[model samples]
Target: MLDPISILNLIDDVMYFPILIIVMAIAGLYFTFKTRGVQIRLFGESLRILLEPPDKEGAVSSLQAMLVSTASRVGTGNIIGVSTAICLGGPGACFWMWLMCIIGASSAFIESTLAQIYKQKDHKGHAYGGPAYYIEHGLSKPKLAVLFCIFLILTYAVGFNMLCSFNLQSTFIDYSFYNPTTTPVIIGAILAILTGYCLLGGGKRIIKITSTVVPFMGISYVIIALIVIIFNIYYVPSMFELILKDAFDFTSIFGGLAGSCMVYGIKRGLFSNEAGVGSAPNASASANVSHPAKQGLVQTLSVYIDTLLLCTATALMCLSTGIPITPAVSGAPYVQNAIGSVFGPIGPIFITVAMVLFAFTTLIGNLYYVDNALIFLNGKTKPSEKFMRIFHVCCAFIVFIGATISMDAAWAMADITMGGMTLINLPVCMLLGKIAIDCLKDYEKQRKMGQEPVFKAESIGFEKGELDFWD
Candidate 1:
């Protein structure tokens, strides 16, 4: 029988590797033009919303919604992913990443906006909406909706969700300098306790945790990278030129460039911010906002935080340090080593703490995603309680995998699974673009008129009919 790896490789080599990038890129480009560059118009507004008070009708506050998404976005992927991309694809990958982010931002807004515009509520008065519901209810295609949800439930629960734990457990075991089997078991124990805390508390608690940890960890890493950049400020100009030269040189069939780093960087960038992937919509839909467009704006802004702010910092830190990482280093730990090459002993300690914060919060945040997917697929989910519990246990097991599994395998699995999530989400966004734009115009109208930005769901004038879930 073929192994699981073979199956994954076959699907990836033949199918996912191509359409995933093309469709996502096209979607991003299309949205950029369609929104009249809304990503640019509302860029500052996205940040401004964080400071303002939330509208109180939604399940969570605006800041909390961003945090929940950030919790998942700012993981080992930000640092290690960036570093790996730079090492293989070279510094030029960073620029390509920024390009992708700029375009992808609008797509992020469109998908997330639709999620809010077509939300479906539970009997408990809490809101539940994402690509799954949007595809089903907005597009009026239950089969396609179920397919999306099934892929998401599997990707979030089995592929991505557990991987976060594995990264955490394994990171700590190495930091603790422990033995082989003991490390994973001990790490699993710690992860189990923490996972239980957030999983039991629900999305509210998960968002609450993210609001505290995500910024702290992300900003902290940026500060650390800043120090490295400062010491190498003199080379900054030459570095930029080098980056530009390598990126455009073109790799392989494209050109003379090595292409390894270029491919890795773009792939890792996508893996990091997850814009246009539809997963963040699950988190964004819970926010009580003045408008659906407002939530979508913030969702797009998060790609900047994940890719431009956090991931770019990792790239600068590694590139400036002159580390011997021209060949990819795996995840956050490689970043730790690169920093340590410059900062000495404190480097590992700093990264260890950052990774713990990054991976732990990711676990909590992604588990909540798993929970949302479960609740979405199985309405009245009490019957799936046992399965949910089993899912939780498997989550702990996956954490062990991240902790001990090969980085190549881990990275490949994440990118492939994330591609899976994006495939389900991007199609719905394109099909429902008109609804998203209508929501954006309504939001702008309310804000422009000096109103408090509260409009009834029906008044937004999207294509969808029912939006009582958010009421």
Candidate 2:
């Protein structure tokens, strides 16, 4: 019998490489052509629209939704995950991640737009939708929707946040001299309390918090990275050369582990941006926008920020530092040493602060997905306050336990759960891809007519009464 870790790796192997990559890549390429490269052509509009305020009395602003999902995307994965990829797959991994970010932006747009088009009001009377809603309402398959929701609850609600906590705790243990056992306990308790507080405040609070914190942390980290990169400007050319050379030269990347470079690159990119994995749509659905594509465009920008900017920063910092490749030199240590080499002892401290902020926001963002899932499970009825309280408490307990576990175990658990989610969601997204294409055409038509686009269910061949909210 396979051990638990081995079993998880097997699941990842089965799902991630051939099917997930192909399905997502095709969806992205199809939409990129479908919209004439919306991610590139609409770049300025995305930024301008991002700064616009939310609809009056809307549940979430487009920016807030983007930030909330980005909070989850730009976590320890950007830091530790990048290092792991480069160490295992060589510098070539960065190129694949960039490719995913570029192409995956289209996938992000399609999924998020469909989310908005098919959005329905929850029991609380606020807008909500996701792959589950689209699957149930569009394809008329409630059971499949339930299965997808279960995957989401397992991935984000339970296992994913545990992975974040584990990374944060590892940073604590690695950088500080506190009692290992006591430090994690104390940190876990504090994190649990904080997480419970945020979860109880509801989705509105989650969006607001993420909107504020995500930008601050992201900008600050990027600025620091830019400073370091500037200081080491001479190494930039060599870094690019290494990435380009090793990208196709598999023999140079993996001495005996041949063919694993592409595998690690794609896996890490999927884990980082989550473009076609059907997660961001949940957040996008909550936003109030005149057109579904507006939020779609906003959510698409998040992929660039996650992999292109933040993940790239980590990759360059690690590569430019000329750090030795070894098991011990990977993950958080790799980042710590890279930056520490530039800034001295304070470098590690800087990374620790960034990790805590990024990981904590990720924990909160992960819970927001679960909150939406609970709303889905309730089936037009709002979750009771008592039920939500119990759920929040359970989540806090999970966080505490996660913080106390070994990093390897937490990561394995996250990979297995996330792989299950990708397996379920990518196919569903493909099934619903055409709806998004039609919606984009409709949005563009209205734009050309010098009108702000508004979605009408009838325009999409749905009777007024068939859709829950978009009448």
Candidate 3:
């Protein structure tokens, strides 16, 4: 009989490969066509809106919201996950990852646009919404909305956060002082304590931290990647050739279809960018933009930043080093070795610090989404302060448990929950995508007329009181 971990992996493969992959591809294509490829046509607008100030001083701005979502999107999946994909699936996986990001960005635009359309404001005038809010109001499926929130909590808080903790601790294995038994325990305790401190400070703290850390870590990592690439400049052309050749190797793709480059690429790409996975929409919905589509457009840029920039940086950094990418060197070790090949001991140390920053921000950014879900679950009101405190403690405990658990278990759990969220969110986005497209058209019309795009629910046929914010 297969062991529990093996079984979990099997289920994850079955869930993603033919089922979720097909659904995601179709949804991505559908949205791209329906929105007339808004992700591409309005790419400049996304950048423009990123600098626009929020209507109120205290509200979340477009840039801050994108950073929050980017915090969750650009985590261990960019480094460890990309290394694993290249090792298991070959350099061709990078090609598929790039393809998925370009296509999947359209889906990101749709879901986040819908989120802004259906967002609700708290008593403090803070805006919040997500897949659940849109499903409830736009689709009028309250039960299904609640179910989506349940899945969000499971996926973000329990599954993804655990995986982050585990990935962070796994980096310590390379150090001479690392004791498998004690190191994980020590790392877990420290991570949990830091996470608790941030979580207790609430949403603003999460946003503040992510906004500060994400830019610095992202820029620093990219700079390191550029240096690695520059050092291996002679191999750059051949590396590109290898990636393209492997990507289209029909025999390899069919022979081991489940383990092919396409499968791992799409899987890791989805996990990394979260373009259609419904997670980023929670952060996207929080932005106080003049038009719903402004935040949506801003979010599309985030997908590129995560996959096209960050994930690609990691993939090329590893592939250019000419390292043997066997399964044994699949995750952090491969990245460490690749960077170490260029910069020696300091390379591994830098990656460890990168992983720490990546995973820590991901933990808190993920909890921000969990906080939104918890409020929705509690009748769209804030949970009791005591209950929230208890919840944060439990979250910290899960982070601790995650660090000590088997990596296979951590990944499998995250994949399953993430897959569930994608399956639920994608179909719903397709069904309600027309509203988002209409919103986009309105925004475009205003822009063409040299006026700022302002959204009113009635412009898209939504009635008075149909939406909490726009109406």
TM-score of each: 0.88, 0.91, 0.96
Specify the poorest-scoring 10-residue window by lDDT in model 1: 251-260
Candidate that beats the other on TM-score, 1 or 3, i.e. the better one: 3
lDDT value, residue 377 of candidate 2: 84
lDDT of 3 by residue, 178-216 (tens): 999899999999999888887787556655765686679
- What order do you get sorting by lDDT, best first? 3, 2, 1
Q: In model 3, which runs have C-alpha deviations exceeding 4 angstroms?
A: 200-214
Model 2 sits at a Cα RMSD from the real structure of 2.9
Model 3 TM-score on a 0 to 1 scale: 0.96
Task: Name the weakest run of 10 consecutive residues (lDDT summed) in model 3.
Answer: 202-211
* Candidate 1 per-residue C-alpha lDDT over 1-471 given as tens digits, one digit per residue, 9 for 90 to 100: 977766665565443345776787899989888888998887887888776666654458777888778778888777666766776666788888888888888888998888887776667766668887888778888888777777776666656655665665544433657676677677766666666555544556655665586677677778888988898788778778877786776544155222444555567778788888888988888887767787888887788888888888887777776666546354555677777876888887878777777776776667667677767677626436677666776666666555555545665577677777788788778988888887788778888898756656677553344666544
Q: Write the per-residue lDDT of candidate 2 for residues 224-337, one digit (tens) a residue.
A: 777778878898999999889888886754454323566677778878898878899998998988878889889889999899889988888778777786667667888888
Q: Clash totals for all models, in order?
A: 10, 0, 0
Give the better candidate number (1 or 2) by lDDT.
2
What TM-score quantifies how close candidate 2 is to the native fold? 0.91
Give the local distance difference test score of model 1: 0.73
Best by lDDT: 3
Identify the runs in model 2 with alpha carbons over 4 angstroms from their true place: 55-59, 122-125, 176-186, 197-214, 252-259
Residue 273, model 2: lDDT of: 93
Clashing pairs in 2: none
lDDT of 1 at 434: 83
